[model samples]
Target chain A: MGIYRSNRWLVRHVDVKVLRGQLVYIIGANGAGKTTTAKALLGLIPTDEGEIRRGPALKVGYVPQRLHINPTLPLTMRRLLRLTERYKNTEIDHAITAVGLQRLGNPFVSTLSGGEFQRLLLAQAMLSRPDLLLLDEPAQGVDAAGADKLHNIIDRIRIELGCGVLCISHDLQLAMDTGDDFLVLIPHEHDEMDST
Target chain B: MTLFDDFLIRSLIAGIGVALIAGPMGCFVVWRRLAYFGETIAHSALLGITVAVVFSFNFMLGVLISSIAVVVVMYYIDRSENLPTETLLGLLAHGGLAIGLVVLSFFPNMRMDLEALLFGDILAVSKTDLVVIWIGGGVVFASLLFLWRQLLTSTVSEDLAKVAGMRPDLTNLCFGLLMAIVIAGAVKIVGILLIVALLIIPAATARKFAISPEIMAALAGLIGVVGVIGGLGSSLYWDTPAGPSMVVTLMILFALSRVLKISYGTTEKSATRNK
Candidate 1:
């Protein structure tokens, strides 16, 4: 897939595939189109070139890097979970417990700490039972210990759901350790088509 | 004597009908920060009036069409251009108002009172005006209720709404149309200049005490109703203009609400902090 702006390529010649039950990480430097590639794969943005064919009956769940909900928006965690799909109380409880956020008593989303918010987002993604989970900077704003715990949770979730996991992150050392396969995006000055 | 025969009675009914609709819609306006958008549509009602008079068309219909036109133009400009929404709205608001005034100046033979068009003359509301206000307000209210969930979700986060399969753009377009309907229906009762004040003040006042979106909307409607009653009563006693008096009444209520909230010592900021 390729993305261009004003006849200049922002991202080009990207070919990556995620398989079931596998963990793949897309690693890149800043402004190297890591998030752009993930968005394109999720069909959030159109690709200017090449074709992206998805498996039949594919269900993809996406957890964005950071969700900046308006402070005035009166959304509780329970209400937010209901926004994407209608889940029963038991299912919601299970998902919240799965994310290790069982202590929160339907707190307002604006009141959540950054790590807690990320866990809530992950719980939201888990609700769909998706065939593939796309996470962008999933450990962002998390402490080192919390990041490790989140990665462990991601591993367990992948194993339990048997779903493919594609994550975008700048933490190369962590990505190298966690990913089964890695796609590294290198920025080039010119708009040349190349892939590794 | 028939109730409709009394001009004051007619004005009260019309004003209350408008408040019922504006209150809830105003909540969305406040949440989305669309005050300027409302002002733009309200200001353009003058252009609609001028066009109706010049072409011998129905004034309300003219207003609806012109307001929708502004919505359409603003939508396209927002999508295609890089201009800030505030700049675009400022240009359109003053431009439409100025053009309407200039056009009206050309027709010295027109019988309509420009002052009434600008500041409103609610005491002169006819039975037909009541019908339009109530019916239009009903439709707007029903539409808002129907789209309430999706609208609230979209207001919270457009990206999340999209992921949830709700189309934010479509919701926004519908909202713009609803605003047009309200502005057109209200132009005769509150005038173009003061319509936004009615839409914004009560909702802002409600925000101080509301714990949820539904409560905020309900409180806004209640406050608006009280403002209408108080303003109309004071206007009858003092022999003052109805529209501006209503706005002043709303402002006073808003001030009172703030004072009461502060004194009661349960401010939202403190409550959130405690949480």
Candidate 2:
């Protein structure tokens, strides 16, 4: 699949397939179309070339690169989960516990620490019991230790849910260590041809 | 019968109905930072009124048509161009207002009260105005209630909303149309200049104490009602302009809310420390 804007290609000639119970990480240099590939795969953006096909009855859960919650919007973590889909109290508790956030009491999403916020996002993704999970730079804004912890949680989630996982990251070495398979997106030879 | 015959009573009802719709819709506007967009649409109402007067069409229908047309045009421009939204809105807001004024100037024979149109004369609200306000307000209220969840999700994050099978584009289109309806319905009561103030101030005040979106919306509606009453009362007693009076009352409430927030924060901190 390829993505283009204004007669320029952002990503070209990319092929990726994610199977159940496997983790695939897409790693690249900054602006090498890592996020663009993920967005195109999820149908968030149109692909100018090639087609993307999903299995019948496929459900996708996505954790975006950056969640800029509006300050004026009053959304607690609990309410944020409900925004995606409704869940029972017990199910919400289970998901929260699964993500290892024990003392979470529905605090506003803005008030959470970086690590806690990533975990909260993980918990939200878990609520859907998705067939495929896509995470874009999930370790963004996190410390090294926090990133390790987040990756481990993601790995454990993939094992526990038995869902296909696709993650995008700029930290190639770090991603290679945790992922079962890796795809490196090299910048197009004529760099100026790429527009994100 | 005499009580029902009072124009003040009619104005009160009309103002309250408009407030009810404006309150909830305003929350979304504030949340999305669409105050300028709302202003642009409201400003276009002057042109709508001019067109209505020139062609002898229904005023509300003309306003709705013009505002929706503006919204559609804005949407396409936003999609096609890379221009900054603020610059575009600035051009449209002033451009629409200027053209409307110039057009109105050509028809000196028209028996139009420009002052009442620019700064609303709420006391002049007739019984038919009340009916229009209520019916339009009811439709807006019901649509908001139905689309509340999707709208809230879209405001939070459009990508996530799309992942959850909610169409942000469609939701926003509906939202823009609803805003047009409210502005068109409210132009007679608040006028174009002060319409955005009515949409924003009460929601801003409500944000201080609200713990949730629903509570914020409800509180905004209540605050709007208070502003209407206070403004109308002050206008009657002090011989002030009704629309400006209402906006002044809203500002006072916003100021009071700031004080309330500060005091409440201090008290809560102290109480927590004691505990």
Candidate 3:
């Protein structure tokens, strides 16, 4: 399936399948439709061509490149994790611990360092026990060591939950061993179509 | 009239009731940075006033209908076109106000106080106005409390809210309906021109001191109540326009909060982030 924004297609003739416990890495450059593809796959945005299907009652957890917590709204990390759904005290603590953010002390989400922010998002994603997990550049703004830890955590989540994982990133070196399959997006594919 | 005893007391009660509901709704307006959107809602309210005048009915019901119509038209425009929202809001705001004024001009013999209709004649509030404010304001207040979680979630992230099956669009539609209801009740308190200021200033001021959403909402209400009381008292003593006086009082409060924020040196951590 493919999606279009404006008059031209963003991504066309794209096909990928992810089974339970499988990791699919969608690698692409800027404007390569990685984010758009992920959004379309989740039904967040509509696609212009082809059909997309998902298992019924599929629970989804998404870690976007950015989680816009408007500065106007004061939100503690604990509150951010609990914003979408209510969780038990122990369950919240467990998710924070799983993401190695156990030292969180009710700091506003805006105060988090970049890596801390990404990890915090990961913690929230895991809270729902999702059946399909999508991460959009999950290792963004993270140091190499932190990136390694993030990969390991994702791999563990995949094994533990047996959820299909879709990782959208530009970095080829990101968790090389974890990805069961890879899809690369080319920039200016629209240009190729325009020329023809 | 005898139950309320004094006109001053009646206006005070009326103003406070509007403040009570405005505080929480104002926070959502601020958090979502819908100050202009609120302005549009208020401006469209002027058109609602015109409809009421033409129909010879209760102004509150008339305002409610017109505002709902404007909101539906806005939703249609937003979905049907890619026009920048602000541009459309500007068009609707001025268009509604101008059309209402022109319509009012056509009926010069209607025996209406146009100034009272524009800037608000809060001190002239009748018994029915108070009843409308309390009963309607109470319902909006309760509904806001019930839908707090869904509202906050949608404000934070529409996608996340959608994932949670919260239906962000429906949540927003509910919010607009509530805002419209409040605007209907507010027309007599602050009128159309100054109603948004009453909604926004208190909430913005309260944000300086609040550490959580619930606190912010509560503090905003308190600020609004204080503004209304102070504004009305000053208006009585100094003979200023009641609605504008209240708005000016709110501004002073907001300025004081800025000073308080600076003196406390709360650091730049919580500085307002542009959306």
Candidate 4:
């Protein structure tokens, strides 16, 4: 797929298929179209050339790179999860527990630490038991220990739920270490997929 | 004239109806940081009024057309050029107001009151206006309730909303449409200049005390209702302009809420420490 703006291609000739029970990483340097490719796959942005086909009854969850919770809007973690669709109390609690976040009692979203906030995003993403989970720089701002924990949770999700995972990574070594298959994105060039 | 001859009663009903719609829609405006956008649309309402007079059609229909037109034009202007939104809004807001006045000046025989149009003559509200306000309020209220989840989700994060299949684009359009409806219905009650204040002040004030989005919205509507009563009462006794008086009441409520938040905040801190 070629996603372009104003005669310049944001991402070109990208082909990725994520099957269930697999974890794939798209790793590249900055401005290398890693996030752009992810956005294209999620259908968030339009592509100029290729069509994206999804399996029947596909449920996708996305963890964005930056979530700016504006101070003007009053929101709790519980309320944030319910903003999209209503899940039962037990189910939300279970999702929160899975993400290893303590039960926060209606605290404003602005108060959470970087790691805690990432986990909150994970909890929200995992709530619907999505068939595919897309992570955009999931460990971008997280500390080392917190990143380890997050990866462990992600591994558990894949092994237990058999959901497909597609992550955008800037750290090539981390992608090599953890990802089942890796795609390297070079800016102004095509995608190169190499399965480890 | 079907129910009550008292213009005061009719004005009260119409003003309350405007407040109900403004309260919820205003929360959205505040949340999305669209206060100025709303003001721009409300300011363009003068052009809508001019159109109504020129075409000699239904006034509410004219207002809706102008408001929606401004929104569509803003969208295209935003996409076609890289100019900042603030500049575009300022250009349109004053541009619409000035052009409407200038055009109206061309026809000296038309019986349009500049003062009454800029600052509403709420006390002169007719029974038909009351009916329009209530019916419009019902439609806006119902649409808001129906789109509540999608609107709230999209406002929080458009990307997340899109992934969840909430269609943030469509929801955002619906939101803009609802704002136009409220602004159109509100023109008679608050006039063009003061309509945006009626929307934002109450919602901002309620934000000080609300713990959740729904509470904030509810309190905003409630505060608007109270502002309407206080303003209308002051206008009756003190002979103030009804629309500006209502805005003053809302600001006072906002100040009071800040004080309450400060005191209440300290108590909560102490209570949390005790826990």
Candidate 5:
């Protein structure tokens, strides 16, 4: 059962499930629990009284809305990639090149522009050859060309690895264009429910 | 000057070692706007120091225990969904400070001087203290180096870090450990209040000039070294407290950097208008 539930805070009585190998998109306004829900699923935040069960020891890859890599952090892509999974130097190079960041793996993360940094995050996510991929606003800072490339990479990875994916986005058109199953978070007013 | 030489050199070495660890760690504190968090953790050291003194334990031992306890507590509070961070830190900081004062008051028979621990006395550091500082500092340095990638990922973006298989909870525990060790190491040199300043101001100074994280860590270390040297020299010559002078040097650097940043900003604006 691909299911999780939480009502710990702003999200009240939330529960959902999807079959394995589904490409699901989660959409909601800012205050809705899209990010919070995602975090809960990832086990970043505890589910209060609920239980989150993983499917068959699946390796989950996530990309968050904002990664505030403090300028003081001593991080290089080569180092960042190593943290994610075991890969040969050539594989690391290939991944970097795949993300359009070839030969820049040694540079510190803080030096990259916004788009470059996001791509690096993407590459790190793919390092594990994960079974489930979760991305939050993968195109926020990406240029049009970069966004296209990111989408293509996501498609390629999914096809090659045969993994499930859950993507959250504020862009409805982009969500529509992706042509995946969608999960919408609509806040239900209790008073309206009482009237019903 | 033999006694002076022995104490000064030893203290300087210890101070630089502490600064090196604290500077980069403090950069994360400043960047995350966790100045209050640092102070809260530091204040908890007093209670730790008091417990150590009352029980006839070594002062460093007491500090280490109390510091670790405080960090563990803070970590728990930080992750608790029920309360906000500012509220949690505020309650713990003031409560710990008050408890420490009370504990020390209860130990009137204890002849140990509390002033040094509260305000720091680098000149009073012993050979044993120096050895502990080295071991502890080395551990912190090596740990940071080992976890450099994970730390950077978590600090910049916890979500991405987790996705990349870096556990933010563990990373935060490591962060707290570094803070606790630093408090224990520097409690004899910079005191509690000024210790946080050492961690923060140097990194802030480095930030003004550096554009990348790797360079920023290096620059922060350099700034810390320079600050400690100047502060130590001035305090020794002028018969002032080492902590205050060190803090002042850092403040002056911060002011200078701000001025330079403003000048550059105006120049850029003018250039853009002319173009």
Candidate 6:
């Protein structure tokens, strides 16, 4: 399946099957349909003409480009940890401390700094312990220090949760270091489609 | 208290319930910049009222049904359309209002109390309405609580929310349902035209002082209560329509927030000078 451009496809025909329990990183240049590919997989944006299939009772835990947590919203990091209502007591504390946000658990997510928010999102994603985790540009807004911290958390989560993860990021070196597999989108294809 | 006094107390209690739900939900509306989206649901209440009259059903049922349908329609359209949300809202809002008016005209025997539907009839509210509002409002509030994290995730970043294995589409549908139920219940007290003002104005005003969603929701609820009560009380004292009075009170509070913001800015400057 592919994402449409004016004439050519943004994402070319890619046939990659992820085995259960594998960590995958989708690496590509800017304007690549990396985000589109993730949306297709989640069934948010429709596939042009392909039957996308997934296991039964497939639940997705997604963090959008922005979490849109209003400053007025009474969201504490601790309260957010129990979103799925299935996590054990210690698990909540573990997830918070894992992201180095144990201290900020009671503070509202909206009050978090850029790095803090990213870590908070990571912590919440890990809380559910899902079968598959999808992340889009997880380090976009994070600083150098925070990005390094995020990479470590990513590695630990894969080992700790034993769940398959597909992350879309422009950080190619980081993806290579942590990602077990890769998918790249071709940006030139969209530009070429407009000319044609 | 007399029978009238009891109705007044119950109405106030129901208002408290509405404030609680609307406060949190409106926080999303203002932050996500979905003020018109809230208005769309409010406008559609007219159609719901018209349908209720046509079918002889409880008016609230008609409002609930129409509100739900409008929200579902909005969810899909928003997902598919590349157009700005405001553009889509303008189309649906005018269309919904026109259709409601036309539909109301068809029932010649019906004394379409346009004013009541436009503003609302707080005095006419019944005991059953309170029960419906509380039960339905309670469920909506709990569901929102359950989805709080995922909702924030999706609200902040849809891609991230999906990666986390929480579907934004499903979360949005749930949010839409919440908005629908809110519009339905609030239309009885605030009316179709002014309902959105109650939902959004208080939340927007609350945002000026709030630092997080949790505090924002609570403050919005407080603002809503203040707006409703102040408006209701003034209407009783001055012999004005309750609906407009409540909306006016909200507007005054909103204005006061702006003034406070200006004063605070000046205070900061003066403190800097002194320092």
Q: What are the iRMS values of all candidates?
A: 4.6, 6.2, 6.2, 5.2, 10.1, 10.4
Better of 3 and 5 by TM-score: 3
Candidate 3 CAPRI classification by DockQ: acceptable
Q: Highest DockQ: give the candidate number.
A: 4
State the weakest 10-residue window (summed lDDT) of model 5 chain B: B266-275
Model 1 segments beyond 4 Å from truth? A193-196, B263-275
TM-score of chain A of each: 0.95, 0.93, 0.91, 0.92, 0.82, 0.83
Q: Could you give candidate 4's per-residue lDDT for residues A1-196 as a string of tens digits?
A: 7787875777777788789988999988899888888888888988888889899999998899899887778777777767778899888778778887756554566667888888889889988899999999989889888888998988887776689999988778888988888888888643334211
lDDT for model 5 comes to 0.75
Candidate 4, superposed: residue stretches over 4 Å from native: A189-196, B1-3, B266-275
What DockQ results do all the predictions give, each relative to the true complex?
A: 0.33, 0.43, 0.41, 0.43, 0.23, 0.20
Q: Residues A6-122, candidate 3, lDDT per residue (tens digit)?
A: 877789777988888899999988898898999898788888888888888889998887777777687777888888888988888888888888875667777888888888888
Name the candidate, 4 or 6, with the larger lDDT value.
Answer: 4
Candidate 4 vs candidate 5, lDDT winner: 4
Of the two candidates 5 and 6, the one with more favorable DockQ, higher being better, is 5
Residue A65: error of model 6 in Å? 5.1
Which pairs in model 4 have colliding backbones?
none
- Rank candidates by TM-score, best first: 2, 4, 3, 1, 5, 6
For every candidate in turn, the CA RMSD to the true structure comes to 3.0, 3.2, 3.3, 3.6, 6.0, 6.3
TM-score between model 6 and native: 0.74
State, as a TM-score between 0 and 1, how close model 4 is to the true structure.
0.93
| Preferred candidate (TM-score higher): 3 or 4 | 4
> lDDT (0-100) at residue A35 of candidate 2?
85
Residue B189, model 3: lDDT of 89
Candidate 4 displacement at residue B190 in angstroms: 2.1
Q: Which regions of candidate 6 are displaced past 4 Å?
A: A1-8, A13-25, A39-68, A85-93, A101-107, A128-135, A141-167, A171-184, A188-196, B1-17, B51-58, B79-82, B103-110, B126-171, B205-219, B251-275
